[model samples]
Target: MAKPFRVDIVSPDGLAWSGDAEFVVARTPEGEIGILADHEPVMASLAQGVVSVDAVGGERIRVEVEGGFLQVLSNQVTLITDRAVIEK
Candidate 1:
């Protein structure tokens, strides 16, 4: 089993979501990127699209973001965006 790591999605309003996730996929200016536990640290510019989080419990949470930045370090992923909405 893949190890879970922390994931936080935040917007100007506040924290959108924060929890343990097994995987994450986000849209970036360069294209889509997938992140897993122990991923190499990285910082990237986000594009307008959906950021998907595969939660530890097998739930998939999707967040629609306008634009922002994504940071991954020490088994944690942080997404800071201007605006975001939780997609049903």
Candidate 2:
């Protein structure tokens, strides 16, 4: 079983998501990046693309992030965004 990490997705408006995830994949200025529990620390500028998180139940939740900054530290991930929408 994979360890779960805290992931928070936020925009200028407010927090769009707050939960635990096994993995998170998103686009950064450089390219696509994947984060797992106990991942190495990182900070990067994000691009316009989809941000997906694998939940405990193995279900994937995706959201569109227009532009933002992503910071990963310890077992926590923080997303600061200009715009984002939950993908149906």
Candidate 3:
């Protein structure tokens, strides 16, 4: 299993979610991408779609985003979007 990484999501309004996650999936202009711990650094423009985060202990978090940017570096993931809402 991959190690957990810190994940932080933010929108124009404010911070949406912050937690430790094992994996993440998001839509980008190029296509969908999955992130794992210890992965290579990346920064991409996001497409309008749902962002899925697999948190520690098998919790799944879903967020709807209008548009944003996703960045991964040093085992930290950050998402900044124009708009975002966490799904119940």
Highest-lDDT candidate:
1
Model 1 steric clash pairs: none
Query: Each candidate: what lDDT?
Result: 0.97, 0.92, 0.95
From the highest lDDT down, the ranking of the candidates is 1, 3, 2
Please, what are the lDDT tens digits per residue for candidate 3 over residues 1-88? 6699999999978899999999999999999999999989999999999999999998899999988899999999999999999999
TM-score, each model? 0.98, 0.95, 0.96
Clashing pairs in 2: none
Model 1 spans with C-alpha error above 4 angstroms: none
TM-score of 1: 0.98
- Candidate 1, residues 1-88, lDDT tens digits: the string is 6899999999999999999999999999999999999999999999999999999989999999999999999999999999999998
Report the poorest 10 consecutive residues by lDDT, candidate 1: 1-10
In candidate 1, residue 59 scores what lDDT? 96
